[model samples]
Target: MILRTFGWSFAITALGLLAAFLYEGTTALGLVAVLAILEISLSFDNAVVNAKVLERMSAFWQRIFLTVGIAIAVFGMRLVFPLAIVAITANMSPFEALDLALNDQEKYAHALESAYPMIAAFGGMFLLMLFLDFVFEEHEYEWLAWLERPLARIGKLNQLSVVIAGGALAIAGGFFADDPGDVMIAGVLGMVTYILVNGLGDLFEGAGDVDEDSEDVKRGPNGLAVATGKAAFFLFLYLEVLDASFSFDGVIGAFAISTNLIIIALGLGIGAMYIRSLTVFLVRKGTLHEYVYLEHGAMWAIGALAFCMLVSIGHHVPEWITGGLGAGLIIAAFLSSVVRNRNEDGKNQSSADKELHSSGV
Candidate 1:
């Protein structure tokens, strides 16, 4: 199983490298490699969080994630979405925006750079809320109900939190966005996207069953149709939300590094493949539970990214700092996880040694 999954990942990575070569030769391939690694490093928490949602999905949806979902993430979010934004915000027709991007690269880059703050802000807010929801909210742990009790009560109050946060950001965004209408639309779309995706996840999860002793088993909804259908919806929804969140930093960062839209898409598009592969690897390996604080670290990264974006709206935040801070938090989490795993392994080994001594020696 490991070999097969690794093979798939390698194959996809090779394909992305090939695409980069075709588009812009070796330099583009090098850039794609860097971005791909950066994205993977930046999104370690994303893999952990996604596993929680995806474990509830059916086998069919999992396949879709590996196959069709990559296209949506790369082409739809990374390439087409930016073009669409340029068209809508710049008052050019879609075709015109495409023409400008392809023909008038300088102008297109200028227009996109102008809109970076808005995309960052929009994507940043959405991701921040998501991070908050996972980190601050109470989790449902059967064995830890005592601990979760208070958190569960607090979690119920999240609707108000969401409303206030979204409303305040919307108002603030009006001042920063180049196209207030477009920002508002995207904001609404993002929230609705979350609702729809999470709702579907609940539905599909309801339809499943598993052994009680299995720590891996996620509780599905109680009924058929509605539950499975809902799970499927949320599964797709979760990926989209995550895709949007990841896109914010990546898309804006791409503009900072290079203005060529084709190059931007090609580079980030290659990066997207690595993210998808990472998500799958996490799911198949049950790596989520192993990496204890990765989600917390990710949430921190999201919060930091959101704040940086807000500041960048009116002022400027250095890219090194923004990217550096995120990378640092994730690395810390990974190191913490390693130490924890080592400690647990030591304890288990000591126990086995004692048992063997008692039995015979």
Candidate 2:
């Protein structure tokens, strides 16, 4: 299963490394490798969260995510998006931005840095909304009952997530952001994007009662109704936006490692491929069903990341800190799931023994 799922990622990684070596010798090859590992570490939880969403998409849409979605993630977000940001913020044409990226990389990095507030504000708020909604929604299983139960109760209030997120945005803008107006606008847009995309997807998916017996209708691995047609399209949009949000920090942070855009793209692109493959692998293997708390952990990691992004506007938060926190949460959740499964197995064994004794077997 591992080979079947990750075979393409391995091929791409090898090819990408070879190309990097050919382009700029051993140093470039090493940097590309490091950047790729950095991306994977920072975004592993993203893969888990993505699996939760991807499982609900139909097979055709899932294929779209692996194929078309990958292109958008790799080239669109890793390469073009940064250039577009530089262009817009620096008040230059696209060609000029491209030249700046390829030639005057130091100046290009500075331009990208100038746009950091807006980037962080938008991505941070969007991620905060995702984490807020997840924790607030009632679920069958609770990893941290003391905290999640209370949050879930409060979540019953209409638009409470939005209210909380709005308050956070206001605080971030007023205190942390240099240009409060731009930060506020960008943050609001992020919130709105989440609402529109998530709301529309849910609206379309639940437009009518699902008929289990219908040929088109199917249950996902997690037992949710699979989204199809228009609903799937909206969901696809949500996924892309979510990916972009996750990419913001990585893209900006990569500048610290290498000003060369090509090396950054090659490395981050390779990591993106692995992430996509891992998402699909989880869905196909029904890993979420077995490790129920994994989603909870991933969401919490997202919340931590959101906080880091927002705080980073005023303070320099190390990438290792952000990556470590996320990795730790995911690992803890996986361990908790293992313990829960073992307990259940022991209980079943004890019950079987009792039954045998009672029946004089």
Candidate 3:
């Protein structure tokens, strides 16, 4: 099943390379493959994180994710969004931005590098909020009067947290503002955008029923169906957002290496394919749950991702070191989990053998 799902991704990736080579050349094709792998490696956690969301989704949305969703991620987020950012930040027309990106790779790269902090700040806040909400927010959504009261209290508090965070972010924006005026504006925009977008996500969530294991009541008549539908939709949305967030980094960084749109597309395309394939593979194999703290490792990776963005915005972190550190954290987490599991198995086996001997003649 894993192979079958990934097979198409592999094929399309190969075809993409073939097309790139035919049209662009060996260098373009090679760069695409490398970028694809880099993207996949960096995004392993994304897949695991996504699987947790995906498992809650209905089959229908999953189908959409594997199809239309990938295209949005590949073309829209990776290709278009970067150009859009370039255009907006540099005060150039979109075509002009594209021309600069393709023709003046060095200048384009410098522009992107300069903008890294702002993008990082935005992406980091958004992702951190997502992680927090998922980890701590009450998932129960029952509408009973007694249930609603306590739930309302918690919900209001969570909203308050958002307000507090927004305020804090606005303050930090002052610190990060290279130009006080521009920084203040970017910061405010970031805060307001985060509030509006996340609030809407929460509002839609209210229409659904309570999760089965959660204490909250189901709001809908067909609780299970509503929950499933909502979960699917949100899961799909989450994947798109996560893909876009990661793409911001790659798209920005890719300019540092090459300006050719085809080359950029090829490299990023290859990287994206690997990420998709690996995500599917990990999900099908249930690697996330099996690895115990791998998700924690991924969370740590997210933290690193946040730090990398912040550093990249102003400071230079060698790509090799940045990527290596994340890779190392994951490997260490895996090894620790393996050791812990082995110790657990030993204890269980001993208990079983003793029980059997004690029962026998």
Candidate 4:
């Protein structure tokens, strides 16, 4: 299972490193490896969240995610995105931005940095909404029962997630942003993007209920009706937006390591492939079912990352801090899951022994 899932990722990693070495010797190879590892560490939570959504998708859509989705993630996000930001912020044409990126990367990086406030506000709020909605919704498993149960109860209030997200935006804009209006606008747009994408998905999925008996619809991992057709398309759209939000931090952070666009693209692209493969592996193996708290952990990590992004508007938060916090939370959740499984197994074994004794076996 592991080999089947990760074989392509390994192949790509090798090819990417080889290309990097050919382009700029051993130093470039080492940087590419580091950047790839950095992307994986930062996006590990993203993969888990993505798997939760991807499991509902059909086989064909999953293939789309691996193919078309990868191109968008690798080239679209890693390369064109920064250039677009530079072009828009620097008041230059796309060709000029590309020229700047290729000929004068320092100026390109500076131009991108100037746009960080909008980027941070947009990505931060989008991720914040995702985290808020997840925590607010009631779930079968609660990793932190004391916190999650209370929040879940409060979530019964209509639009509570929106209220909280709006409040957070207000706080971030008022306190953290140099230009409050721009930050507020970007943050609100982020919130709106989430609402529109998620709402369309829900709307189409609800529409699917009319034809639930049809072969195109099927039960998802959660036993709820899984979306197909237009519904699945919207869900796929949501996944892409979610990935873009996750990539915002990584893309910006990559500039700190290397201003060379080709190297950054190659490295992050390799890591993205592995993340996509891991998401598919999780779905196929039913890993989430086996480790109930993993999703919760990933959501919490996302919440932390959102908070960090917002805070980073006025302060510098190291990349390691964001990555470490996420890794720690996930590791803790995995350990807790192991303990839970052992307890359940012990109870089952004891019950079986008692039944055998009573039956005179």
Top of the candidates by lDDT: 2
Please give the lDDT score at residue 237 for candidate 2: 92
Across residues 19-85, which tens digit of lDDT does each residue of candidate 3 receive? 8789778877777777777766666667666665554445556567777887887788777777787
Q: What is the lDDT of residue 345 in candidate 1?
A: 96
TM-score of 3: 0.80
The C-alpha TM-scores of every prediction are 0.78, 0.96, 0.80, 0.96
Q: Write the per-residue lDDT of candidate 2 for residues 234-343, one digit (tens) a residue.
A: 88899999999999989988999999999999999999999999999999999898998999999999999999999887777889999999999999999998999999
Count of clashing pairs, candidate 3? 6
Q: Model 4: runs farther than 4 Å from truth?
A: 219-226
**What is the lDDT for 74 in model 1?**
78
lDDT of 1 at 212: 37
- Local accuracy of candidate 4 as per-residue lDDT tens digits, 1-361: 8887888788889899999999999999999999999999999999999999988877778878887888899989998999898999899999999999989989988888888888989999999999999999999988999999999999999999899999988998899889989889889999999999999987777777777785556786567666677878998899989999999888889999999989999999999999999999998888988999999999999999999999987777899999999999999998999999999999999999999999999
Clashes counted in candidate 2 amount to 0
Q: Model 2: runs farther than 4 Å from truth?
A: 208-216, 219-224
Candidate 3 vs 4: which has more TM-score? 4
Q: Model 4 — which ten-residue stretch has the worst lDDT?
A: 214-223
Query: Whole-model Cα lDDT per candidate?
Result: 0.67, 0.91, 0.64, 0.90
Tens-place lDDT per residue, model 1, 242-345, is: 77776766676666666667667766766666666666677676665677666556666776776677556656677667778877877787777778789889
